[model samples]
Every structure is written in structure tokens, then in C-alpha cells.
Target: MVVKNLIQHLAQLAALEISDSEVPKYQAQLTDIFEHMDQIKQLDLAAIAETFRTTEEENVLRDDIVTPSLSQAEALQNASLTHDGFFVVPSVMKDKDAT
Candidate 1:
């Protein structure tokens, strides 16, 4: 794609309002990025393994232990409206024709 169209597309994707004067700067930067990607694409790496990550890091998750929680009375203490043991909430969505 042409630099001008690419810049406009990038600006739209990024939700940016670019001035006419800034177009050249963005175009130059995008052109450089595309050039680098093209250079990488031209590389011969048939012997290399596909690497998802370069570091040996793992996510540490805590044990799912049961614990004491707030009672029904405590939970509904700050509620404006409550029926039985549940909090009452107003309807958030309305019919389109109601407008």
C-alpha cells in the first residue's frame, strides 16, 4: 500500500487525529518500520526453531482455598433495595420505541 493510504489507515486504527503537517513524519516512520519487517521477512532461518518466548518464566497461581466470606445480612447492609437475600437492581436497558 502507498504511504499516504497506509498512514491514514494506521491513524484510523490508532484513533489518532493527524494534521496535514504530521503526515510526512508518520509516513517516514511507517516506511522505516515496513522496511525493517521486509528485511526480516527476507532472512533465511530454516534451521531455527519457532520461539514463542526467550525467557524461562512461569505464572505462579495460588491454591484455591475456601475462606470465610460476608454473610447475606452483611452483603445487603449497603444495598438500597433487597428481596429475601438478593439485592434488587433497576432495569438498565429500555425498549428502543420508548424513546
Candidate 2:
């Protein structure tokens, strides 16, 4: 087959100037694969239903349920400093007293 011939041609490419570790195995496989794919492309499918070619299966999902996130207070509960239900940190801008 043309694919096999292409694979053989690619395998022979290892003898070309390069490195000993270099091999065209993937290139050869790609050549063969594309040739095989060309066979599929050659099909006369004017009457075949394309949807039947799909392999999709039905999906199963869990039931939706109400969920709650941490409230502002709970979210900052582990903060090192808390003030009036909010996290407090040193002022990023220089305080006027420090200036």
C-alpha cells in the first residue's frame, strides 16, 4: 500500500545525515496515518447520515441544591486583625504622622 511505502521511505530516512538518536518513527507513523485517513476521506457518503457517526453518550448530572458561601464575617474570621466585621491591616499609604 502507499502508506506502507511511505512508512518504509521514512524509516529509511534514519540513514540520512543527522544524529544516531534521530529517528523518523513518528513522521513515518504520521505518513502512514494520514494515508489511512485519506482512505476514509475517499468514501462516497452522499446518503449516509452523519449523526450516526457520532459516539456521544448521554450525560448524568447531580440534582441542583441550594448552597451557602461564607458570610463576610466568616470569610475574615481567620484574619490576624479584625475590626467591626472586617479585616484590618497596616495602612499601605504613609500616615501623615510618619511623614
Question: Against the correct fold, how does model 1 do in TM-score?
Answer: 0.55
Candidate 1 structure lDDT: 0.83
Q: Quote the positional error of residue 5 for candidate 1 in Å.
A: 2.6
Tell me the spans in candidate 2 whose CA falls farther than 4 Å from its real position: 1-20, 52-59, 63-66, 69-99
Which candidate leads in TM-score?
1
TM-score, per-candidate, Cα-based: 0.55, 0.37
Clash count of each predicted structure: 0, 0
Error in Å for residue 44 of model 2 = 1.5
lDDT of 2 by residue, 1-99 (tens): 334454456555643333334335555668678898999999999997768535566545677887988889779979999988888998776544463
Q: How much is 21 displaced in model 2, in angstroms? A: 3.7
Q: Model 1 Cα displacement at 53 (Å)?
A: 3.7
Candidate number achieving the greatest lDDT relative to the actual structure: 1
Every candidate's CA RMSD: 6.8, 15.8
- Residue 77, model 1, lDDT: 100
